[model samples]
Target: MRGGPYLLLLVAGTLGVGRGLDGQLGSPCHPSGRCNVRFSECQDNICRCSGTGVPSAYNNRCLPVADGLKGYCEENVQCTVPHSHCRRFSKECECVEGYVMARDRSVCLPVSRLGEPCLERAQCKESTECSPSLGVCVCRGISYEYDGKCVTDHISNNWELTVVTVSPAAGSQLLAHNRWLLCIALAALVHAGVR
Candidate 1:
């Protein structure tokens, strides 16, 4: 963004990574500062980007920052995902406590139990928590994980969340569980800046 169009072409001419462009993210570079990659510098023997330039989970690529859940950031201001903020450890946009990315990936919504999707334990509703292996809301304590809501005596608490009572309905959710996990993993890769 600093230079004219010809400057991009000149920098793009460098070889070995990212469309053969020097200063292209994740490309190997020297200790001497290179003007090609913006907001990036050679660190730990690799060309790493800072700020909006996010590295992939594999650290293979760097992507421009955005306001989505996958956007790379160091501060809360960098992300604008609904009900979301920058997570310090991951350095990416994530839902605030008591919230998680919706199934549609558009917004962060309150977390509930009984198969509602979640990323962390705090997102789950009371008496429930996010399951690390399953990536869905699961019952805690003495509750049962039936339908889309947890129950103590198999009695519905009458939660507004979509409820399923039939055996087939619960069976169908098995596939959904896998799908949610896949989505979470993909989001993580993109969150790391795979884009």
Candidate 2:
């Protein structure tokens, strides 16, 4: 009976062989069948997800490919269920309004020109020129608007034309003057030759 006190002290001082207050076996995963390799913890059952699959080191989630699929979320975060898009750099998923998937399927863009209200040159198409007053890009042929209606032409006010007229009477008078001078010169030359 004297050894009973010493044995009790030895059992109390035992290391790594006692059960938790809740009687959990070893770790939460061993008893609950759920493990979080990424977080290195037995799930507290709050966000209960099966950790049986491949473990992810980055997010510590069940799936190994949760972060992204390479270039798809390079600059942007990977798209999640609630978020429309994922931005890789910021690591956030957000919804982009008025922007739809482009033809290439890699980028999201506005549906049409009307979708974006253009107030500057950069917002217009390459062929179009921006008119800030109207807050949109007008095509080359599209006329500018005055009041409420479109003006067919907004030509520069400095344009001018020179009017030229041909007078046959003036031409005939000049021709006669030339003939009189020629005859007088011819007469003088003949007189000098005779001398």
Candidate 3:
């Protein structure tokens, strides 16, 4: 009876040690078992999965790393698309600024210039508008019409005019006119290197 109790205790200790070793040697994944990429682990003798990093559609199965633009990704390193970035919130790759997602969502393309076809505002360059009715980008509002394009009037022309409106409560017509004359005089002085 003394030997039997000792053997039982020994067996229990060996089983505890075996379980500890399993924890150290067991893989989070198992062969022939499906799991979301790096997002799941085997737990409690079952393939337990979570949805935190895995999309709902892929939560039930293992999915290969995406290879193109706008593809699902866990990190930027996994995205193979050119000029793209991984958005953690959406778990997908997206194009950087000055670029647009292609129609197929497989690549990033340079933004359309003036008069080019555009499907969205992001498809056009800055200070340009995508005309929904015309199906092309156009520059409007104080922009100069150039050779089949639009350019900033003030910047490209190298000059700008500032209009100052005087409030009627602050000044009479004559006073406003005097303020304009003073502004013109100051501008002339600066132009002639007199200031």
* Candidate 1: 10-residue stretch with minimal lDDT: 154-163
- lDDT of model number 2: 0.43
**What TM-score, over all chains together, does every model reach?**
0.30, 0.24, 0.35
lDDT per residue (tens digit) for residues 65-133 in model 1: 665886678666557576888888989888888777866666787866668777767668767878889
Arrange candidates by TM-score, highest first: which order? Answer: 3, 1, 2
TM-score of 1: 0.30
Reference-based lDDT, each prediction: 0.65, 0.43, 0.62
Model 2 lDDT tens row, 1-195: 999999998776543222222323223333333333333334453322343333333333443222322223322323432325555465544346645443334344342352245544544553454566776656535555444334443333222233446498976775687988656555555544522
Ranking under lDDT, best-scoring first? 1, 3, 2
TM-score comparison, 1 vs 2, better candidate: 1
- The parts of candidate 1 lying over 4 Å away from their true place are 1-67, 113-149, 152-195
Q: What is the clash count for each candidate, in the order shown? A: 0, 7, 0
The CA lDDT at 105 in model 2 is 40
Candidate No. with top TM-score = 3
